[model samples]
Target: MTCLTDGEPSATADTDTDTDTEGELLLRVLTAFLREDVSGWRTRSTPVRRGDGLWLRLPVATRERSRGAALLMPVLDDGYQSTYAARLPLLRREPGGAEFVDTAGVLAALRDLADPVDRGGFEAFAVECQQELDALRLHAGTRREVESLLSERYGVDPGSWTGLAGGLGYDTLAARADHPVYPTSRGRSGLGIAQLRSYAPEFHPTFALRQLALPREAVTVGGGTESWLSPRAAGAPALEGSHLVLPVHPLTADGPLRDALRTAGLEGRAYLVDCPGPDVVPTLSMRTVALASDPTRHLKLPLATATLGLRNRRTIKPGTLTDGAAGQRLVEAVVDREPRFRGVILHADETRFAHAGHELIAVLLRRYPAGLEDAVVVPMAALMCPAPGGDRLLIDHLADRFHDGDTLALLDATLALLFDWQTTLFAHGIALESHQQNISLVLDHPAGGGGSGGGAGRTRLRLLFKDNDGPRVNLARLRDVMGQQAPARTEFDDRRIFVDGDRPVLDVFTTITLHLCAGSYAFGLARHGHAPLERLLRLVRERLAEAVERLGTAPGEPGALLRAHVLDAPELPVKAMVTAGTLLSKERSGAADINKHYTTGPNYLRHDHPRQNYPRRNYTRPTGTS
Candidate 1:
């Protein structure tokens, strides 16, 4: 036996809010999608004619609100038939930049400014709201009542959202919308979020939805190629656009989640990666794949050769990457260049990655992979996860101990494998939607991959990774991707999004610990601890020092990139970062926010090579069910 697993749980602290590495990264990318003019909030004495209808961006808020909080506030009026509210919270700013709710006070102020006609419209709208509520056939009362109605009214599913809403005692929907103490672009939209959360939800046509909300026009009756969880069912119909998969519940709090799930958990990957596929986007591909075998088989292609976001759905949606020729073009580009870049894992088909630069990103990766990369290719259609093994709870292999060392060594190997798979996203302007289920564990014999000396020289062995099909990388997470600026490296900033929360240095640390260290733990803590943060930092320090010594002061992007690695020492200046880890052996429940993303254990093993015979998670959903 390599090493015994560490059943001990880590200690944790109350963090009303934990820093979201990916959310910060995405802030940079989202800006490109839509820009908000801060000037809109100010009273322009000139009051130049604004957009014809009151331009509504965000709801009026003042307090901290959770799912369905919008329903609580009275919809106020402006001069236009439609009221105008900007996305920005109306009143005060919340800490951590949560979206502030536009409060009644803000509405009153807007109402006062509006021409009487618009004000009348607001009043009329408010009146209609009551009628709408009275007619709610599913209104059972309490937050739970509202939640039930949501599932009934809208085919939403229950997952981690349930736990979140459950924590709030939100059986009834709030009458008003509260201001986001800190608005999260990373958060879900309107009732869509609530529906998945506390209750079944309904969408008022007027409510503007954000990313991840179920689209009004998604779903097809028997049109999509459906398979069944049971043998008897055929493809009944596929929900149009991105269908709801399991709540990307992952192991958020390392200490507790790990103990509960008994897997190292995918929390680190969750914060470190964005999903890699495009969301409800259009694929301009010209290739015409057979509707039936086309999508399924296409999805099976090697990661280096396919677009992950675009699934073979019975129906299609806008903003989602399309399946066919255009995607083929991008896929072909990356595949062709694989050798040039040493090795590459390409994920383009998933709907979540719509905004990740399609071809351009491919080109950029083609360049970098050629320069620096320890490559491995996993052709798996597993559940969404970050760490490599989370795709499968490959327990079968864990029991087999054919070698020496310990589980810690096995875990390190596991992490290195997952990191490489996930890092591909950053190369392509995408993020790995690495929750737990997304990874898989595999057994690899070094000789099987092509012989003893592994890595770039040979296949080394197969490591687990999900086949492309999960959430797309939110283009918005560029901020977190470009952690701490590299003083001397201009190249480091080339792909970096300066705005939002882009911080590449921190991202690296997250990747190594969460993804790498977790794998180590699986084998046992002993082997994994060898590559402790201090040791890793030392390695980086040595690399940087050597580079500077030889080059006599680094220059440009190369210098910056190197500087970022050194600066991204596991020990960062942020107090929030200091608390990333908790004490070991503490028995506790995982945090409400982070608990859902726990990775399954079987997919990886500490010190164990990737397991081979353990590929599964490729189960096609049963037909006729949401």
Candidate 2:
């Protein structure tokens, strides 16, 4: 097989905590720990409102009342009311008085106060956080180079490139930003600095895939790979038996796949091909790579790295390939039948590939439909991420370019389109994990009439969704909407995708779609002084109410329950991402699905508190600190 080559020149360390990158990892983690209260930290702590923001006086169990840690948080305006600013530090209070602590001090204090059961996990996470910080520092120079390239290439018009190029460009931009919740998002647990430089998207690495020859009889196969597979690209091997070629990630080829092949006693049946296969570049999700020859075609391969959490592997499970395709078909049926979704929502075709029933040996092909070459496709996450210059946000650039410099109008249009599709899907018994990363906005001017920051009124918007393996689908209701002959009747290998009750369905919608996707941008925009958090949330509530009303409010139905739980309830369900994704095990957390573990958080959508959003400023300071 092809040897792993260093894909790009390594970048040097460059960091500025004030504008970009992990200046606030420790504080962000602590804020989430308290807000989720997964370990009884919030109830024990006292909250003090300092100016517009809220500060948590954390109890130091080892110290007397005179000594404690106080963390300032950015007040949110939607469901899951608490959040932290990445630009802010932490405050340490003691008998000698309160002063801001450095990153190391925050980590030591957190370690000192952590519970015995959670201490190990917390320490592991802390290590990952530091690694993530270091990685970002190394990535800082390369990130600026990428921004410069895109800026110089695109000039004042972002839509100048084809849809696929624009989408890939925006994906690179999104990769540079920190995750709103996962504090150690950039940490690649199994990879060293060199490996990260070769494979990670932030580095913009392009490398060839390693090929393996597997006996046709020994592996389970799905969609066809004949059209793209070639002698020049994937080595035309003269095998003695009937064998099929499987494209493997260069990294996975060296680690898990070799071991798995040996364990399965297929040493003689499958052999590695000594050829550099189709050159590919990584997307935001490192495991899924885009073909360098034709980026429209993406290959999802198994990887040994862990991101988001130490326990969360990047390997592609055997069932995931088919299960994800099945979910895509079901969603396709919904989009086809729903008149409102016509020309408004599009899905990536993920129906082809082959698998050996092993996580490391599976491949799923992602094909993008035509017509994207003309529009600008950007993931929702990229809009709010820190911009390339480290001065203005990405949304600022988009707003100034496409929306006539009106950020509020751009956000309003986005929310209107998002709610229309998402709410309708919920009404039809499908709740997708349409977080910012999974969803993209397709924007184009009517009849190609607008450009150079002049297309404000005629801009048309659509939603493009991908990664459909984890949605909660009401099978019976889906079949009703799609009819008996529709593909909605397809069975999935992952039964977690099928939900029997409304609670589970609503949980996915509330936690992922509303809180993570919608609420995240709302908070980001508010924190950046784009608009009042309450005003944006009021728009959210109104849009949600309109969707519910449009869907019919039959009592106890999905729409009715969604309105009640999200708009009226004081506490809303939120995924305990840190606990489930990193700190705890299934047995200890008692989580049926580690990704779905839930906890109650304050619902800021409640109409009772109609106030102005907090002004943008440093939140780490004490009540009266100058």
Q: Give the best candidate by TM-score.
A: 2
Q: Which residue runs does candidate 2 get wrong by more than 4 Å? A: 1-23, 48-55, 58-80, 83-88, 91-115, 152-161, 224-233, 446-453, 476-490, 610-615, 618-626
Write the residue-wise lDDT of candidate 1 on 1-626 in tens digits: 00111452212212321112222212211221112111123222112223432222333343444422221111112101012212222332222333323233333444443455445433332222222222121221232443444455323321111211111111112111110111121112112222222211112111110111112222111112322111112111243333321111111121122332223232232121122121111011111111111212112101111111111111222222332222223333434534532333333233222111212111000001121122222212111111111221112112122123233334444445544433433333333334332343333334444532212122233333232222222234422333341112221212222223224433432333233334223221211233333333333334333433332234433234334432333222111110111110111212221111121112121123222222121111111111
**Candidate 1 lDDT for residue 198:** 24
Clashes of each: 159, 2
Q: How many pairs of residues collide in model 1? A: 159
TM-score, every prediction: 0.28, 0.87
lDDT of 1: 0.24
Task: Kindly state the number of residue pairs that clash in model 2.
Answer: 2
| Cα lDDT, model 1, residue 299 | 21
Model 1 stretches with alpha carbons more than 4 Å out: 1-336, 340-403, 406-437, 446-459, 463-554, 565-626
Q: After superposition, how far is residue 482 of candidate 2 from its true place, in Å?
A: 5.1
CA lDDT, candidate 1, residue 450: 50
